[model samples]
Target chain A: MHKLYMGNRQKAPGQQFITPSSHSVQFYEDPEVFLEQLAGFAGAAVGAGGCYLVLATAEHRCSLQQRLARRAIDLRMAAAGNRFIALDAREVLTTFMVEGWPNRERFFASLEPQLLRARSARLRPDAPLSAFGEMVALLWEDGHREAAVHLEQLWNELLGRHSFSLLCAYPIACFAHDSRDDLFARVCREHTEVMPTEGYTALQSDAERLRLVSTLQQEAAVVRAVVEERERAIAQRRHAEEKLWRSEEFVRRIIESGVDCVMILDPQGRLEYISPSGQQALEISNLSNFLGRSWVEFWKDEDRPRVEAALAAARAGGIGSFQGDCSTPQGTRKFWDERITPVRGNDGQVEQLIAVARDLTELRQAQQIAVQAEKLAAAGRMAATIAHEINNPLEAVTNFIYLARTTPDMPEEAARHLEVADRELTRVAQIAQKTLGFYRDTSKDKWLHVRELVEDVLLIYERKMRNKQITAEVSVDPELRIYFKQGELRQVLSNLLVNAIDACASGGRIWLRAHASTDWSEGGEDGVRFTIADNGAGMSPEVQKRIFVPFFTTKANVGTGIGLWVSKSLLEQHGGSLRFRSRQGSPSGTVMSFFVPGNANLQVHELPRSA
Target chain B: MAFLSRLLAARAPAREAFPSFSDGPPVSAVRRPHVLVVDDETLIADSVAAILNRNGYDAVARYSGLAAIEYLEKKRPDIVVTDVMLPDLDGVHVALTVRKVLPQTRVVLFSGHVSTTQLLELNSAAANSFELLSKPVHPAQLLKALQPAD
Candidate 1:
């Protein structure tokens, strides 16, 4: 039987059983919690059985016996331990307490065989824990005069079988059968009175036996059912959560595939999540470091305030946006379109701020190119009209000269008049020719002297500048040689001077300075810089930003607005850049700087020496 | 006293009489040579007047063909020098008008911008009494065109 029960612990088959005089039983939905309740109940049963015999007088013995008998009958009726505890009347007397002789000798004798049998019965069929616990408790209560020794041994056995020390509390389960008139109550009053000391401490052995036993079983059953249901619910919830995770991952992948940067920000303006596209657009490696960092940190310091304002406004409303240059580790990037939208919670408070920034730098550059082409087309039309209009009058004058010179018998005074007429016609023709030659490439690969270019440009403005009483100071390095179309250089210089004159208020000084740069890395020592400065009302930064844009002019009627645009285009084509410094409403005026690289290497191959 | 009497009775030179002829009646049977000087610009007309005076032709300048017709009805001109761009009508119309009103008149039409094809079409009329010339006209061209061939 011991081997069989040991086998049960290892993998015992059903059908093995034991016959016992009495048993205790419990039912539960969970095996573990029920085991705890069984241990507690068994502990009370030990104390209850021992105290019943020790305290029993003749007046209480009959009632106690009847109660024990009734309880045993109820255990059988409940079929509680029937599967693990066998029912046999003759063997029941030996196993249960047969209280007959004094000094408890007969009861001890009757229980000796059962005590030995209980030792082996501990190894009975692989019974449910409640039945096994009941068998152990009965053997403890009725086995011998040294029942206390057997109880300890039984406790050691059960504890050795179950790892949790809480199960060793089974012998303490003797408190279960305590009653006022019963012998166990008297014994509890003597030996187990240590129970009624404090709240839970008062739950010691026999004193609170009824409360402990009933509460233990009831709670165990209830907790077992609750645990099973909770586990089922948790499993179902995990399945639903996995499904949601896959869908969110799909959406994240789609967002990453797009070219536009998409990001989610929390209410604190920190980056909560950024799509892969956002990382690529912003040129960042890891999104983890970006998380919980302020979104404004990604923008330039000057742009942060505006970005924050835009975010705040968007969060307050449904939609808003801002435009600015964002400085990243990659480079300073210009973004034309940034859309911000707020995700609101049920309380109408913004929960998150979602932003999509589409790179508009390419689009803006394309638009600028198109506008430049259109402006050039319009300029071509105007040039054609002016050319046609001026040429007709010039041709008429030329033809009239031919006819006048050919007429015979013309007087000396008439010849002199014809000469004067021819001179005036020549002046008109020059104007027509100059107007037609505006910005045209007529003179190419010319090594024009810087002095000559300056002198020619100044000649156009000499009379006007003098009339305005504006002094001119020009310095050109006589030795500096530049290879370019002389006519184009003249046009660029003329336009610049004209613009400077127009921008300057009356009585303001204009400075035209040209010199070789001291820095060799910019080019050889031959690199020339032309700085044109004036004392007049300067333009604002906003004006400076759009100054090079086609058709953007401050002087409406007097300016076609193509002068600066053309100058810039020409300068860029020549591998140069134009930079200007200005402050609005200040007399400091504007200083425009132009850099021309004098590649002596170019002169070696292209320049023809006249000397 | 005899020299002053001689200066008052003697005939003025043709150049001195040129400025006064278009201002009033014809000095002789030529009917003041009611010249129709055509130009689109006002400055060119003023300049042309100075040239015409250095010569001996009686000239009246109008900026458009319509204005020339109005001036002609009041005073029939013996010649016309008109520009191609008039405010209402062109120099061709002025030429056609001069041919109709004064059949013996000569017309010199000037323009700086007309295409060769347009010029040919305008000069196609043999009875048009006109010759085409491009602008920036010299004073000699005006004198030569105005000189009567013997």
Candidate 2:
């Protein structure tokens, strides 16, 4: 009986473990344990007058030879007698490998010679020949896993014909990946005897091994539960993060698309973030230039105090708001209804400030338009009433004048005086008729001669201009005409003329000019352009900037503030525009020019044809 | 010119015999068209009535629309000339009433305010039946309007 040496002085099951024609496999992690087992197997074969062959890596082969030398096997004498043969596993694998696979004929052709020589060198022909090979291990390490398993099968087939005991060894590290577990099972199945690594095989007793196995099983269960809990925690965190990201995206979209400007300021009152709409509202092309700047610095100098107060209030964890004017970088004045609210941290202390600004420029203009319309309506009603009241007495006077002129006996000179008086009264009646006409026929569009419209407006303001001792030099084309809303145009012209008259001092000169011209701005449409220039005290630059702003007036209480604004709005409604130039230096004056298109039929429906 | 001289000659006697119509028939064989001048303003009513008399029409003055309507119940005039805006009744109401009372009598309306034109025009029957004149009405224009349609 042949006994295989186990490292712990334990006997493996099954006698004749290294008998002739036997195949075995060893899976090992520790090289020392593997070399001890190999030394035992090979030493027994040499002592039995048998042959021993080794096909392994250089390191393992060198270590095995040294161990055999220590055993006094006399390897040099054994080699001369054709007993011990050692070869590099990689070199031997190359001789039989055909395109990374072991061809059966090449396998026999490469290893049969070595096997026969070792068998024939045996002390007796029937002596046991034991061979150890790590070639399969090398193939598995090189990642030709199929070749390694095929080579194992070929070795089994070769053992049937040869009388040698074969041993295949693999490093436990070769099956490190979980996917190689099936390959490990297959490799074990290919061998008649399979040896586990030292971890299982080195146990002193079966009871001890069983106890260790039970402990390992319990540890594996605990590890699996811990891993599942960790995975659950990680998944919960990911889900919460995804929800947070989605909510942030929703808020970002709202802030980006909203019309109101939203801004965030640091507790120190410096701007930290501005929404996309805020950047547009502030007319900022580059946010970097405005970031970290004091938020109050954007307002006008006169309004800075109020803005600063609001910011301070919000920084103190209170809400503040104001309606004020601020100019953009492009110097366009804008009105903003801005509210500031404090953003607090968990500690209930102010951490940031949020400012939401609603553009009030358009709203303010709309409100002013409504107020001006109401004022104009009231004025129209009053004028109609006054005209109606005056017409009664005027009619009585005209009747008396007619009767006096029709007297049976009258002197020629007296009759001529009465005739003159009657003609004068007719002029008065014409003025009354024109005043009443302003309120009547409000929705009619008609062609108006430039001279006649001018004369009509001048006639109403003639007394005022005369009282001011202002002289108006009128130059107009007699045939210059415009077809538009009569009352609206009349109102515009009246506003301009009245402004000019009011601006002029006593003995001041006013130039009123009208000509048939083309509105080049609107692609050369035939139109009439009127220029009313006054050699009065011209306006300052500040006043000129806000000239068209509703309720921005320089003429304290007497002026209705929205006169020019209403006029401009009315003209714009008719596809026209009004502009002015003024200077305050010597020979300074203001020249206001406005253009009216000739054909306004297309604009008739766009606006109500009334003042 | 002869009619003017005759009117002038009759003016003094006519002034003394003012508001003294016989209520039966005229002393002259030539029939005069009877005219009713209605106005809240006494001066306007009296002057218009006097002018119509001088123009050879038998005209009477009523200072109120109610007084004019009262006068109409007694005598159906050939024409009713009234101010549109009155203290008691608007001229449209008076004109519509006259159309009901005396279907043959023509009504002429005058108003100092232009709004009355819209008011009259809004009432289709009054707009069609009555001719509106804006005030400070000239004597010739009034007389032309008062003339017989034929």
DockQ of each: 0.12, 0.28
TM-score of 1: 0.38
Candidate 2 off by > 4 Å: A1-198, A201-210, A247-257, A261-276, A283-318, A322-335, A400-424, A443-459, A462-486, A496-568, A571-611, B1-33, B54-57, B100-104, B124-129, B136-150
Worst 10 residues of 2 chain B by lDDT: B8-17
Native contacts present in each candidate (fraction): 0.29, 0.41
For each candidate in turn, give its C-alpha RMSD to the true structure in angstroms: 20.0, 9.2
In the range A554-600, model 1's lDDT, one tens digit per residue, is: 98987867788888888778776678888766446888878765555
Quantify all predictions' global Cα lDDT against the true fold: 0.57, 0.81
RMSD of 2: 9.2
Prediction 2 TM-score vs. true: 0.64
| Model 2: CAPRI class | acceptable
